[model samples]
Target chain A: MAFFAAVNNWLKHFAYELQGEFLLALKTIAAVFRRPFYLPEILEQMHIIGVGSLYLVILTGIFAGQGFALAFSVELADFGAKNYLGRIMAIAIIRELGPVLTGLMVAARVAAGITAEIGSMKSSNQLDAMVAFGIDPIKKLAVPRLIALIIMLPVLTIICDFISLAGSWVIAKYIAHVTTTVYLSAVRDRLIFGNLFIGLLKPVVFSFIIAFISCYKGFTSGGGTKGVGRATTESVVISSITILVVNFFITKIVFSQLKGWL
Target chain B: MIELRHIHFSYTDKPILKDVSFVVEDNESLVIMGPSGSGKSTILRLILGLEQPQQGELIIDGDNICTMKEKNKRKLRKKIGMVFQAGALFDSLSVGENVGYYLLEHTNMTLKNVSEKVVQMLGFVGLDAEEIIDTLPDELSGGMRRRVAIGRALLSTNPMIMLYDEPTTGLDPKATENVLNLIMKLHQEKTIASIMVTHEIIDALRVANRFIVIWAGEIAFDGTLEQLRSSDDPRVKEFLRPFLSSFTEVVQKRFVEGIATENNSASL
Candidate 1:
């Protein structure tokens, strides 16, 4: 009887948590539609999540694109396939590197900040105070940041793709001494809008995942300072791992279906 | 208008409040006194609906709070104002912002009206209206922060009940008097029901119409202040013995010192 009771309680708690997540999602949607658009809050979040991430994303993009180009050039030269350097770099960054790098950078920078701020508010009763005052904290706090991330992450990924390709182009032309004409011709021949569109898609999904997970963790944090710390760690770890996992599944499914069309 | 019937609350495995019951009437001041860790604050939390009692009913103004839904709980909470032990003001917001938070969230008042009300509350709390209302919580003195917390609680004007937990703790004599006077004045003028938890026996006696003393997780004494003062119970006498002894010492020492000094002066 006790074992069955414990199992029943576990099921109950699981259902409760599921309901909470559903409510949160509904609240997020409602908040986006209800209030007058807060341009200032969106702009602030953009500056924090997008503009501040530029340096790290750019640095990673340069190294990743250049490294892939150099390594592939060496291997392909042995088979007389060195001319494919531009194509490889363009495809690699557009289809995978751009989204993955940008997602990881955001998981580190933007998601961590969101968790810390919301966690502090949770521990201090500010969130409760907000509820007591008839303000939906999910609307006031979470939705603005989520919407901002959705808008900003894809834009940042596009910027990263452009910069990474530029880095590869410079390395191919200047150091490897491949002609500028050949590099440009190779990229123009191989790159497609589908590649760019697929790259852009991941960041939007990543942003939503990151925002929802971090906000949920922070909002549910208990046990004060230790709880806040645990939430922050969980936000970063869970977001990064989820992004990687989601990226793989999305890539396989999207590319496989596209291949069928081809 | 708050009533608790046979409340039993615990944290983890230890009981904090067992068989605790009390009723607070409208416009009446109820002071809950007890030693440290006697669960005085837990009672306040239960009344605020921040915590649910394990095995009893909490009815506030004819509604059962324990069985209420979350939305209704929030509605009930709005009718209540609580001054936490640490004031618990939003550290990120300014004094004015903190006080005006509820008004901005709940009402359709214009910013101008909110600003006017903020100024009025600050003035009522004896805080300088012209001073920088944007000063952060860390910038304010302890007493000032407590006053701002009180002001924030007063923002929702005409809450059915006000609950204060250790409101006068960590204050100098003058500041304590200020807080005590504020509580009395708010009670007298607004006719708001108040439940204040404090260890300051004198302050409680000064403002309380009814006193409820808890000992070891039970309601040990419940009566008017006159009844409490005249009670012959050993626990009551033991608690009040320090104050009574101090009073007698002052009187006896003054009499003896006066006679000795006069005799010495005459002999000289």
Candidate 2:
């Protein structure tokens, strides 16, 4: 009975937070078209979320692609199918690894930053001040970040996909001793327009997940600076987990559609 | 005008304001005095519509805030401004930008016009706009930050009613005097309805035409300074005891010195 009661309470709390997040997402999406566009603020967040996370995205992309190429070469060699290295690497990286890694990196960087900044403003009564002064913090704060993430995450993920393939090409040519022409042709063969389309699409969903989770965490934080720190940690952890969970379902749908395309 | 009728507010089941009622008419200032954590700030929060009371009618400028929608409440909020305990200036903005924040956001004023208004408001607060325009909130001194916050709210909305949450607490005497003088100046020049929450007895006596003292989440006394002086309430007396003794100490010495001065003047 005690175990059941504990589980019930935890479920109830989770449901409450989830409901709150849904409403916040709806409000943020609606606010995107409302007046007071805050162009300067949106541009500022673009620089922070898109430009600031570039180094991490590049680093993750190249390393993951290189590692995958090394592992794939050994397996393909086993079957005397070394010629298929580029296609296999391309399918895996663009269809899954590239977007997931980019999403995870942005979650760690941008989401944490958003949570800490807004959390502190909330703790210190600045958000209340904005409320008191007839300014909506959601429109002023969260909407700009949302717009930035939605616009930038796709761009970031595309770059990541390109860089990852570049890494695969390098590894195929230098490490696996495959010719450049073969590597290029194989990668080109493996890509359908649908794969690239889905690769680009995943980051838009991921960006929304990261922005929504971080903003919600920030707005609800309390207990001053310690609370802000806790919110930052939670935003990063929750955004990362939610992106991965969502990635699984999204990949399933995209694969089904791609099979129809085939 | 602002009125709170039987306001009831609590935090996580701990009552902070219970059946508290007060009114401040247009062109009037009400100063609230209370011990720490006695719901003085909660009253301001209710009126600001930042926190709705569990039970009450918060009337402001002819509307009930308790029933207002969040969107409507934000519109209602433009008529009010507040200065917080720690200034609460937007840390990301420069001083001039903070002062003109809402104006820039909501109004169609050109950049030059907004800059001019920012400079004028900073001047009203006795600050040099050119000197501090580029300075961040963290870069300013405590007194300067408080002044900048006041400038921000006052110039941003041109609010009809203002609320101050212990603006003078933890300040040196000179700085405290400057803030008090500024409050009086605004009262004189703008005829703005205002509520100030402070435990500073001298400030309450000086600034308020009417005062309310809260004790244990209820109003223990509400009246003029003279009425407060003659109150038989035990809680009010206990709260005023330290200040009363110090006041008496000064008066007693002054009375003795008056006799000596009178004799010296007579001999001369």
Candidate 3:
């Protein structure tokens, strides 16, 4: 009886949190269309998320691409199919690995920053101060962040995809003994519109998941420093996991719909 | 004027304020005193429209805030300025930006003019505007932050009321005195009713013309300073005991001196 009661309470709490998150997302979307848009705040966020994450994304793409290419080269050597390394690398990196890995990395870094900054403000009563001053925190804080993420995440993923392809090229030429012309031709042939579409789409969804979840956690955080710390950790963990989980669903849905195109 | 009628508030299943009622008139300085968690600060929150009571009518200058639309409520909030605990200055903004935030957002004031106004307000609050304008809240001393917050609250042109929630909490004695002095200065300089919530009775008595003590979510006592001193309520006595015991001589002497001064003025 006690176990059932606990489970029931947990379910109720989860549902309540879900409802809050959904409402926040709706409000943020509505706020985007509302007048008095905070252009400076949006530009600042774009700079922070886009220019700030450029180096990290580039590094991740390089290493991930190189690692995958090295493994593929060795495996294809055994199968006497080393010539197809570029095609396989292009398919895996662009459609499957690029968007998901970039989302996870960006989530881990950006979500924590967003949560900590907002959570600290909350603990310090600045949020209440904003409310006291009659400024809508969602419009002032959440909307700018959501807008920045929406614009920057796909851009970052594209850069990550390009860098990863370059990294794979280097490995394929040096290690797989594949000719550069053949590898480039193979990659160009396989990099279809469908692959690019799925890759870009995943980041857009991931951006929403990261921004809304992190902001919600920050806004709801309490108990001072410890609470802010807990919220930050939770934001990163939840955002990363959500990105991974949602990536699967998006892929499943898109693939089912666009099977002929793929 | 601000009125809270039969205000009942609860954050959860347990109630924080039960049937709390009070009225604060224009330019009236009110000191709300209570033990911690007795809903003293909650009253200020209720008035600021930061939190709505589960059941009550909060009328600010005739309109029932309980039923006011959120947009109208926001407009109503312009007449009320709040100095949250520890100043609650925006951490990311510099002191000047924090003080001029309202003007920048609400008014069509030019940046140059807003900067001048912020400087003037900061000076009025006894802060050296040039020295601190560029400084962030985290760099300032506790007292300085509170002063910046007070300046921010008072920056608007037509503020009718000011709410200070534990404004002097977590400050040194000198800092507390500085903040209390600033509050008294603002009260004298502006036609604004001030509601201050504090645990310090001496500080409360120094600034407030009237006192309301909340004990366990109810008003235990509400009257002038004289009535508060002469009250026989056990709860009020218990709450005031520690502070009054130590400062009885000082309080009595101050009252006697005040009466002597009044008598002297009457003779003149």
Candidate 4:
């Protein structure tokens, strides 16, 4: 009987948390269509999430690209397949590593900040004040962040993809001794429009996941200062895990359906 | 007009309010007093539709908010505003922006018009508008933040009902007088209906027409001033006995200051 009671309590708590997240997401969607869209707020979040993460995103892309080219081109040289290094590097960065790495890096950067900001607001009763003013927190706060993430993540990935290709070119030529012209021509030849489209599309979904999860954690925060710290940590971990999981399924679905495009 | 009927609320296994029933009419001030965690603040949250009771009906202006839909509840919320314990001003916004936020978001007011209204409201709160308009909320002292919060909520052209959660809990004596005086002045002008939740008995005795003291999630005492002064209930007296000496001294000084503050209302 005690075991059954314990299970009942656990199930109830789980259901409540899940229901809260679902309600938050649904309310944000409704808030989007309501009057008084906060355009200034949306623009502010865009600058913070997109521009603030630029330096880190660029550095991560460059390092990933350089490392991939050096690691594989060395092995492929023994088989005289080093000429295909540019094509492989381009495909890997554009299709897989670029979106996943960028998503994770942003999860680290923005998700933690979102959770920390919102959680402190909760602790200080600012969220309650917003609600009392007839301003829905989901609409005024979460929707702006969600919209910013969805708009910015794809733009960042496209930039990262090109920068990563550039890094790979430099590594291939200087370290692997591949001709710059041959590397550039091979990448241009192998790349298809469909792959680029699908690669960029992945970040849109990943970013939505990051924004919602972080905002949800923040809204649910309580206890006090320690609670805010915990929310920040949990937001990053949850976003990172979800991004990786979603990336795999997206990769499988898009690549499988569009095999002929490649 | 707000009424709470046999409301039951709890967080986890800890009960907050049990069978709490009360009614507040327009142009009335209801002060809820109790020890910390006696659920004084919860009453305001219930009224604002920020939290729903586990059981019972909360009717505001004839609408049963506990049974209402979320959309309808939010619609009802436009008639009310809350002042939090720590002011709860947006840290990212300037003092003027904080005051002008609701207008800027909900109205067709131009930026220049909003700025004017903000300045006017800040002056109403006895603040120097131009000096503080562009300053961040964090830059202000505790007393200033609370005054700015009041200025933010009290100046709307529409009638507003206000819920204050410990509005003067941690203020200096002078700031407390100013805030309490501001509340009285606002009340006198019929600018807003008020329900203030505080543990400060002097504030309750001075400002409230009706008072309710909660002890252990139940209303232990509910009475007018005369009834409160004469009540024999040990629980009620225990809460009041220690403050009897200081209450009169504090009230006299503050009441004098309050009258002086009212004379300055014309400047607003």
Candidate 5:
């Protein structure tokens, strides 16, 4: 009975948090519509969240694609199926590598930075100052980040997808001595627009998860400097882990439905 | 303008304010005097609606502030301004921005209008409006930050009440005199109720029309400055004796605590 009671309490708390989170999201959306457009702040957030993150994302993208292609080519050669390398590379890049890796990189670069900056503000009572001034810190600070992530995540994922595939293409054509014509044909036959579209959905969900969790952690950090550090670390770890888990479940659902739809 | 009745607050299981009660009339300046850990600051927080009393009523400006919703509480808080012990100025914003933050948010004033009002308020606080308006909080001296904080509080444009928590904590003798004078001038000119919490007896005697001394979470003495000075009460005598004998010591201690670390590091 005690165990059951604890479980019930946990479930109730989860439901309450979900309701509160939904209300917060709705309020934030409403505030964005009500306030004057802070275009410079949005552009600044985009530069920080998107442009500054490019080098890390590209480096990870290139290596992931090359590494995956090299492993798959070796395995295919052992099975006397080296011609399937392009198909494998295309499918893996579009279906999984591009979105998941981009999400993780963004979790490290953007989410952690947002959490640390806002957490420091909270600790130093700057957020309290905003509240005392009747400006919702959520509206001023969180909204720009939320909007930036929503717009930039997809763009980053697209760039990651393009670069990763290019890396695979280079390995297959130049290093592995695979003919360009054969590689292009195999990719054309196997890869579809739906696969890439499915991958595109992950970044949007991951972006929301990252921005929401990081902002929530930072906004609610009550203790001082130590608390800010803990929140920053937690934000990155939680966001990255949740993105991967959500990506897996999304991939399963999308591919299962796609199998029938196709 | 503010009344507390039977306020009971505790941290964990240890009580800080137990059945504390007081009243400050409109335009009246009330000084709360007590030694450290006497729940003096807790009373300020209670009045400012920062902390809710566990069992009591907090009435501010004829409103039941204790039970008000957060939105209503925020509205009520606008009628109140607080100067924290450490000034609590936003380090990220300029002095002018910090002072005019409230007008920018709660009013439809343009940047130009806000800047003008900010300059006027800075002048009222005796700060050079043009020189330090763009400076950050870290750029200002301790006394200047306190003045800017007072300016920020004044920007609300005649708050119904001002709650100051240890306003004279870290200042030299001259700076303390300036702050005490500003408090007196503000009370006389603005006609707003002010509640000041300080252990400094000189500060209490300088501006306070009435005094409330809290001892162990309860009001030990509540009356005029003359009554407090002439009272036979042992607690009042003991509290005032230190102030009377060694005003210089009090000033020196504050200066040492405030400036010593910075000077030591600078020399190194």
Candidate 6:
């Protein structure tokens, strides 16, 4: 009986937290359409999340792309299909690697940053102070981050895809002994509309996941400095896992919708 | 006016305020005194509509905020200003920006006009606005931060009442005197009522017109200064014992000064 009671309490608490998270995300989306847009805050967040994550995203793209080309070249060479390296790299990187890698990296970097900044604000009474001053914290703080992430995540994904393709081209020419012209043509051939759409779509979905989880963790943070640290870590972990899990579902949906197109 | 009638508040399974009730009439200076975790600050948060009570009504100026919508509560908030412990200034903003935050965000006042108003408020709080306007909050001393917070509170169009939570807990003697004097001056000049929550008996005695003592989530005593001084309640006595020596010293010093004045006048 004691065991059953404990399990029931845990289930109830979990359901409560799940409901809170959904409400927070919905309020944030509704806030985006509300008045008092806070345009300057939105622009500042765009600069931070977009410009701040550029170098890291670029580095991740280059290395992942080069490693994929190097590894796949061996397998293709075994089958005397080395010229297909470009086509394989392009499809993998554009439809999968580029968006997922960018999403995870951003989940680590931007999500942690957003959570820490907001958690500190919460711990310090700024959120209450904002309310006391008749300002909505969601409108003032969360909306800018959500809007900025939505705009910048897709842009970052595109940049990552192009950089990754560039990195693979280098490996195909120098390391794989595949002719540059053949590899380039093979990559161009795989750059169909379906792959491009999926690549862009994934990051947009990932953006909402990262923003909602991080902002929710932040606004709910308590205790103090230790609580802020705990929330930041939780934000990153939740966002990264959600992105990976959601990526698979998004891919499944896209594959079904664009059946046989590739 | 503010009133809390039979308010009951709880967090988790533990009650923080149990059947607590009080009132502060217009232009009244009411000091809430209690030990740590005695639900003193909780009362202030409840009055601010930051937390809801499990049962009872919190009426501010005639409206029962417990039943009001969030939008109306926010509109009502403009009538009150709060000063948090640690100052709670926006760390990212400069002193001037922090002081002028409300006017800048809520009004159509241009930066130039807001800057002027901020400068005026800084002077009102006895800070050098010109010298410190551009400095971040972290750069200021503890006393300066508290003063900036006061300035921010007063800068609201016209706050009918001010709520201060431990405003001088960590300040030095000089800073404490400055802050106490500032509170007194606001009472005299602006005629704004105030509710101050503090454990500092000396500061409370200096500023309060009446006192409400809370013990363990319940109101133990409520009365004027003389009533409190003459009370035989052991809980009140126990709460006052540690600080009675310092309080006695202040009274003794004033007595000596009064005698000196009498003697000097007789000699003349």
Two-chain DockQ for each candidate model: 0.37, 0.77, 0.75, 0.59, 0.29, 0.71
* Candidate with best DockQ: 2
Flag clash pairs in model 5. Answer: none
Model 5: how far residue B18 lies from native, Å: 2.2
lDDT of each: 0.83, 0.89, 0.91, 0.87, 0.82, 0.92
Reference interface contacts recovered per candidate: 0.33, 0.80, 0.83, 0.73, 0.23, 0.67
Score candidate 5 by DockQ: 0.29
By lDDT, the better pick of 5 and 6 is: 6
Span of 10 residues, lowest total lDDT, candidate 2 chain B: B246-255
Which stretches of candidate 6 lie above 4 Å from their native place? A1-10, B251-268
User: What range of 10 consecutive residues in model 5 chain A has the weakest lDDT sum?
Assistant: A125-134
lDDT of 6 by residue, B1-268 (tens): 9999999999989999999988899999999999999999999899889999999999998999999998999999999999988788999999999999999889999999999999999999999998999999999989899999999988964799999999999999999999999998998899999999999988998888689999889998999776877789888998988988886775566558768989999999
Runs of candidate 1 with Cα error greater than 4 angstroms are A1-43, A188-194, B10-15, B35-37, B199-202, B215-217, B229-268
Please tell me the interface RMSD, in Å, for model 4. Answer: 2.1
Candidate 4 colliding pairs: none
Q: Among these predicted structures, which one has the highest TM-score? A: 3
lDDT of 1 by residue, B31-59 (tens): 99888898998998888777888999999
Residue-by-residue lDDT tens digits, candidate 1, A74-166 = 787788877777888878888899999999999988888898889988787777656656567887788889988999899889888888888
The residue pairs in collision within model 1 are: none
Per residue, candidate 4 scores C-alpha lDDT tens digits across A19-67 of 8878888888777888778888899999999999999889999999999
Shift of residue B186 alpha carbon in model 4, Å: 1.1
- Among the numbered candidates, top lDDT falls to 6
TM-score of chain A of each: 0.89, 0.97, 0.97, 0.93, 0.89, 0.96
Look at candidate 4 and tell me the lDDT of residue B180: 91
Q: How many steric overlaps are in each model, in order? A: 0, 0, 0, 0, 0, 0
Q: Give the i-RMS of model 2 in Å.
A: 1.1
Q: Which DockQ value does candidate 1 get?
A: 0.37
Model 1 chain B weakest 10-residue run by lDDT: B246-255
